[model samples]
Target chain A: MSTRGQLLLLWTTPVAGVLFLAAYLMFPGFSPPMSPTMTPEEVAAFLQANLTATRGVVIFVNLIGASLVPFFACIAVQMLRVGNSSPVFAYSYIICVGIGLTAFILADYCWGVAAYRPDRDPQLVSLLNDMAWFFFIAPAGLVVVQNLCLAGSIYLDARPKPVFPRWVAHFNVATAVLMIPGAFAILHKAGPLAWDGSLSFSLRLATFAVYVAVMFFVLLRVVQQPVESEGVLL
Target chain B: MAITTADAEPLPDTNGNTTAPGLVPGEASMWFFILGDLLIFGVYFVCYMVYRGEHAGLFLQSQRHLDQGIGMSNTVVLLTSSLFVALGTEAARAGKAARATRLVGIAFACGAVFPILKLVEWLPKLGAGITPGENLFFMFYYLMTGLHLVHVLLGLVILGFVLRSLRSASTPNMKFIETGGIYWHMVDLLWLLLFALFYLIR
Candidate 1:
């Protein structure tokens, strides 16, 4: 297998395995946040009221997740580089990914997951918690693994023997770095848009503004075919 | 010598010449592409599970409202249709164009039955005003199954075109056959996932 084939296989295999045994694995570290029910105005009022170390950490971790998307975007070309898919397949690939793109554009994970209240109906909350657990097993796992694999694949491909072009490697590196801020943003949300404390409103908007800007650049790149060498697609 | 082509295979437009080392095409990455799609939808699937687990009661409540038989029937329809496409691929590869075309026609008909069945399944939900983004159940139902349905429709369209092409074209290339087969398999694969995720989520 080519390096990427191996990388993708490795990248994808764990996700598949985990989803298969999803019910078995215990999701560690990333606990669900409180489920608050504050209104938008209340959320704005709360953001103005607090700044602390723990709050910063939450924002930072969430930032890491939300910002990780560009790396996924970087993979778009590299994955395509690995082979010539049928036009329909290619079209579907992009469309399916386009759906995934909603996460970044909406930034709901940080805004909703992190900022919500913990004290809702015990029954309903427990149900939401279980559902969240299910999510961590597959979609969340794949997102992390896929991003890491794309980064690794790009790096490995950058090595002289790799089939992908050098630019993809550089793109991967840049993408990994670029993804951090948005990830932090995603990690900072609440079930209630009103209550969770993460970043200043200005920073949130600025973070999202930067995210949207970067996302546009990445989206443009994903749509354009990368320039390739004799045996490599950049 | 004037290249009066009684033997030159028509460029996939019509079938005339048959004296050949079969104008076969190369391998396709359709499987790879489908795997890629699986990965993409795989995320959504996980998301559904996560959310479902968190809100199991709601989802189960919503699921209870669905007709399991309808979902199961659609699954059977797609699987059998997929088999027909495979048969078509085999016959086409063997240079039995007529048999391949017939199989493709059957496959197309099978593929056609799906959205019809889905339409029937969806009517009750539509009447109930259930839709994606409304709640966890509708969200996964429409997002996952709706997206799958779109792919099915697209597959049927492709299958129809290929069937038509098969009937009209005299000479067929194995490459086209292979690629078309790959496309059909993707359609089939998506349905399998839909069946697993949409119907069996409970």
Candidate 2:
């Protein structure tokens, strides 16, 4: 194998394993602790009452997640490569993901613990909450990160030798701009900008949906012939 | 087969910043795509994190149920696969075509094993009657790690391609290996996280 190939493999292998392990180990009921409001006895009763279908959606999600991760990742890797701005954006994307992953996982375990042990220290509980707040739940910083990547992709594609199309560029910009409110909407609370982040979460997400649909359409259009190798798409 | 865009003459020295000039256009574009993907993953992650925040005890209480041994074994599988990928790249660069082919084959094999082992690990659990929405923690667990599994399958497919290319005397290109390797590294990194998330926390 070439050194470049070696380097690529080094980065990807662990991620692949994690993907696999995550699928299996992080199953439904692996981290059970749902009824924060009810006492343990009451919680058991509640679970007994609503036993059949409660975790069904989550299992459905697992089936879906098991499928989507690889497919999306491939597209993502290829899309970034469709043009040539790897050096500028690679580390940022990975690091940000690294941060997000850490946050997600930490919050995951902490949530499990807190759920199981209701009598745990309030401070510890709060600290865990804070961790999730900073790391997992809020979509604010990440929304920008996505846009930045999209913008970078467009900016690169907008190059003289354009590997992608001009419409794709326009589409990326529109998506980036439209996604701004989503970050705040994710929290469903008064963020720094206030005002309920402009109403419903669905609306915020809907704006992004437009971006996703358009971007995918544009990507399909651009991929028909990605011939220009010499220049950045931007 | 015939002269394509690559056969086009190298442009005159224009940009002076060709430091690691080996980085190909294909490689660079992949990075861009990966970065974008990260954002999507980040959003999902953010969702997981936010919910986790409100219910820390609920989350960790269940985290202790994890089986650390299997998690660690998967990590080993990933790390070993990475090493094989690296060695495979080296073999190709050295022009030892057969060596390169074998190493890539091993890497691919390693990749395959991880997912299979994953299945082996999960089968019993599904049978055990545990489920997501069993609690708040389970929800995120299924969401985060489930996403990761999909990536693993994809990696396995890609690795299979790399190995096939090797047999054809196409001898995996340095750029392909590097790109794939970097991606492999990302998979490995995610596992360390799983360990921390599921096992370490408890």
Candidate 3:
């Protein structure tokens, strides 16, 4: 692929994140997540009312979010170019990002299924809603692992001048560690640990979005450099 | 490229002793991880305090279930381990390779006691039907401590690598040793906060 094509592919990483956020906004996900305390009937009513919007937005979410595969693949390719070390870190990053992106797409499908037949049993609808939210947030640790892989690769780069700066590697590792607390969302219903709570959902999403943006710019700069001078400057 | 050569070469002191100067011990990247890790923990701590304030009664009641004795002893163990690690890092810096290895080995042994004591404290409480599911306080306690336990386990692995590097290399990789030391100290610092929040807090 041409260098421009490759850089465009990498840009998909942040674009996908933004698309997901837009989809979330369309579906009112920014409000406190659907509480477990809601009765089946209440959940069913909510789904029935938002059926069209939820289905349309999730379909778009699934399509755009799949772009993450190519995005992360580009990252793996760049990582390989910067170092002669084992390809393990780069490969693991691609694998984890692949799995994480798949989970995200599947989560949208789960939501789609919930909105498909609102006339169905309310309890089943509630169950599917629960499934969608849990599946969306729980696998966050995989993304964490993916970040760690990238960070490790950057840190181990033997080039006299590494493609990514040392601080970026540190940022990636820190972001990975920050993502862990979100897993506790499964254990709570109303508190900050809840799926919609500030720590689990808000802060996590904010950090992830910021991370994607930062990395997108960093990688963009790296790609813009001449092929021969790739690692010569940050 | 300029910085790389400078980093690779040790500087000579006036006394003719050569050492890397003004270099943050460990991989510079590790300090980033350490600072960010602490910030993450800080957020959790703030959340804990907010919840504790909101549900002071339940938090206090749950705090009673924690065994202060075990918690205190674990604190001592981790602090002592951290001391040994600090001493070991100094030894490595001084080029006493064998001594650094032995001191870090001792640190590793001390760190190994932590999980055992954690299990001792947890098993009885778990057997008594107290779990993260019991209430909010227990949930926070388990989640935070569980995450710290993961860090401790990882620290042990890092320490193993540090020991291996010390033993295998004629001159130990100061960066690797310092990185491990910083990580272990972060682990120690985290436990101290956890001890205060979970065990001694009102």
Kindly report which residue stretches of model 2 are placed more than 4 angstroms away from their true locations once superposed: A1-234, B1-20, B24-26, B43-50, B170-172
Model 2 / residue B28 / CA error / Å: 0.6
The worst-scoring run of ten residues by lDDT in candidate 2 chain A lies at A1-10
On the 0 to 100 scale, the lDDT of residue B48 in model 1 is 79
Best by TM-score: 3
- Say which prediction, candidate 2 or candidate 3, comes out ahead on TM-score: 3
Ranked candidates, highest TM-score first: 3, 1, 2
* Local accuracy of candidate 3 as per-residue lDDT tens digits, B105-175: 99999999999999999999999999999999999999999999999999999999999999999988777
User: What is the per-residue lDDT of model 2 for residues B1-202, given as tens digits with 9 covering 90 to 100?
Assistant: 1213342478896434333656552267677667776777668667766766778788777776666777778878888888887887778778777887788778777777887777766677666765675777776676667777888888877777676666774544656656776677677677667657656765
Note the B-chain TM-score for every model.
Answer: 0.81, 0.78, 0.89
For the predicted complex of model 3, DockQ is 0.02
Positional deviation of A157 in candidate 3, in angstroms? Answer: 1.2
- lDDT of each residue in A44-111, candidate 2, tens digit only: 44434443433443343334333323323323443444455444454455555555455545544554
Model 1 spans > 4 angstroms off: A1-234, B1-32
Q: Put down candidate 1 lDDT per residue, A150-209, tens digits, no spaces.
A: 445545442344434546545544544433333342343443221122332223333434
Clashing residue pairs, candidate 3?
B26-B179
Report the first chain's TM-score for all candidates: 0.33, 0.51, 0.90
Best by lDDT: 3
